[model samples]
Target chain A: MPDFDFHVSAFAWVPETSRGWVKCLRPRWAFEEAGFAYRTTRLGPGEGGSDGYRAWQPFGMVPAYDDGRVRLFESGAILLRIGALSDRLRGWDDAEEATIASWVFAALNTFETHTSRLTDGLPGAVEAVSRRLEALEAALGDREWLVERFSVADIAMATVLREIGETAVLRRHAGVSAYLARCLARPAFDRALQAQFADFDDSRVA
Target chain B: MPDFDFHVSAFAWVPETSRGWVKCLRPRWAFEEAGFAYRTTRLGPGEGGSDGYRAWQPFGMVPAYDDGRVRLFESGAILLRIGALSDRLRGWDDAEEATIASWVFAALNTFETHTSRLTDGLPGAVEAVSRRLEALEAALGDREWLVERFSVADIAMATVLREIGETAVLRRHAGVSAYLARCLARPAFDRALQAQFADFDDSRVA
Candidate 1:
């Protein structure tokens, strides 16, 4: 056990829902795979409030992490930290490691940037995101996963794609859709989704 | 020392010239500080055509890095990797490291987003960016730097802010202007800027 608890500041519904969900989910799965005992603290809408959260995160964003030794705010950085703790997410070699890191950024910065803009109500956002999806599908053409096997990059990207999966835009992209299915089928992802959604609905009702 | 040479794809310009310029300058300084040999492959101006440098980067963006180990894209990710190579940039401890990492994202995603929009030539973009500059000025007020001392976050932000600093809108923020001045004073920054601009006139003449 690493003797660390992860605290995530997130909202149930927002443009960043998928990212927030993944932040709460991936570490828990990795920790479980490592057989490490860890707890998660989920902040509610009014519980942390805007000012409180922004003070902790100047960007006023959610999915911040507080490991026993350090507090990390970016999901990518948190994911990288978690990946460092175990061999399951990172590669054994330097070249592989750099590739994994590049894909991680591509997932969040390149792909998600365009995807989020689509969902955020920009002009022709849907069309733009559809083109990006086609690009991703082409990138993933025959591969079951992005890198070697199912790594953190897959986890991070699938989580982001889940937001758009509900739309008709992604329906045409069979490879990406199948990849997402493979990701969600994992027991840990399922459990985490349940827990996250349960808390999400609880907040809405509250 | 690390058995690596950095090949960066960027344009030649002053720090305050634009977002792309600032992004390229910061990590160039970091590499210089690390005593690494590097080459800048400049792109010519077009949607994705920059002086015939398009093939070097997949996304056709400035500041893509190619080390002997692997090619890495995205300015934020590149900065994180370079900062990780040394203890000087990571901070005194893990806690400081996490804090600094969080602020790096804040600068790129939050502050830089607004500032980029302000310079994007849209209506009200100037005012929108000015407001962000004021908030950044307030955040940076009286602080010699963002973290325990001058760190990668400061370097990343100084580069990004340099673009906004060139505009009349951002120039009105005294604190930010002063911060930019302080950043330019560093010898590493001077060398990086000189290197980036060394071939500017020649390329223009050609």
Candidate 2:
């Protein structure tokens, strides 16, 4: 793909706290991992809800993708599509693809749901998060990645675990902590995170 | 698929409130719409955490699917895989497929997230759910479905909305209410819901 041939909606300005961790980086990482070239179309987070933005993403979220061939809004869906572009990051078989996708959904919905409660200071919520983390730790036993290799499942689940980042419960699971470390150490993730921060800085300068 | 060739792990007994509307119904609905044959494997919800179940679904959740060719968990991922089986419930082109996928994500993650608060009775939550409902209402504007046709997006979304059936916020959006009605009216959904309920009934008897 040529420069600007494919456009992905990115936050023109994410708050400083969420700078390197915005949802947009999932697809950026996928693009980098798959070595697919693309460009960002920045819009304010609030502008995400505007009619123009909603045309691409109905819920007014960022990281929608478009090219001559396809337009997609969900970052998970976008990452899956990008994975389809290169065999480097995913399995070629139907069973393999389904396994990878199942983990993606688990990361986003199940594991991600618990992250919301890790810092809420409610005993019930804290317990809920702990139970989920234990389950994850058990599943990851002696494996570097969720599946046989580092695929979109890694990109999705690791991104969610990345949000937990040395928090109280996460600190207790040495295996999980090590797993997240391995995921973040990937060069593709480093590039994506760097670009996200760089984009925020450039937008501020403008 | 032969007898027991494909297995969907369903609740051995879902509570009466969730019987027909269990998460398994999403794939069941998808399989029905696509007219693919499959079978269900029953296990208690807690039994879902057993070694055998955990091998298939890490989270011990119901609605895990396995054919000789594919095994998938996560209702959303399962529905997407089913959509791939036949264009009967999805778009033909890449762009169209992306459009359908975006709505599926919006339904499962965005819209479904807010539904958790509809009955929580917290002023803040109630207001948040209301806001999301309004956005969904605005997006639906005079459309029969999220995209031009009834696809897995509808199966995924309508299933979520059905969870909030006749809630305060839902009643305000007659369009969404009617959309759910239209979705439930589909023969595929009716068959799926009935089978799910029958599964529960059979388990109770056994």
* C-alpha RMSD of each candidate structure in angstroms: 4.8, 2.6
Tens-place lDDT per residue, model 1, B152-180, is 88887887787667788867988888988
Task: Extract clashing residue pairs from model 2.
Answer: none
TM-score list, all predictions: 0.77, 0.92
| lDDT (Cα atoms) of all candidates against the true structure | 0.67, 0.79
In the range A31-90, model 2's lDDT, one tens digit per residue, is 888888878988854788789887777767778898668888877788787777667887
Give me the iRMSD of candidate 1, please.
3.1
Residue lDDT tens for model 1, A41-149:
5555555445556556554455677767788876776777777666666777776666667666666666666576566555566876676666567657677877667
lDDT (10s digit) by residue, model 2, range B1-206: 34335568888786667678679999888888888887899885568889878888877877899876788888888878777666688687777788877777777766665575454443355676667777777888999987788899999889888878877778887888898899999999989988898887453544
After TM-score superposition, the amount by which residue A23's alpha carbon in candidate 1 deviates from its true location, in angstroms, is 5.8
- Looking at candidate 1, what is the lDDT of residue B142? 87
**What is residue A93's positional error in candidate 1, in angstroms?**
1.7
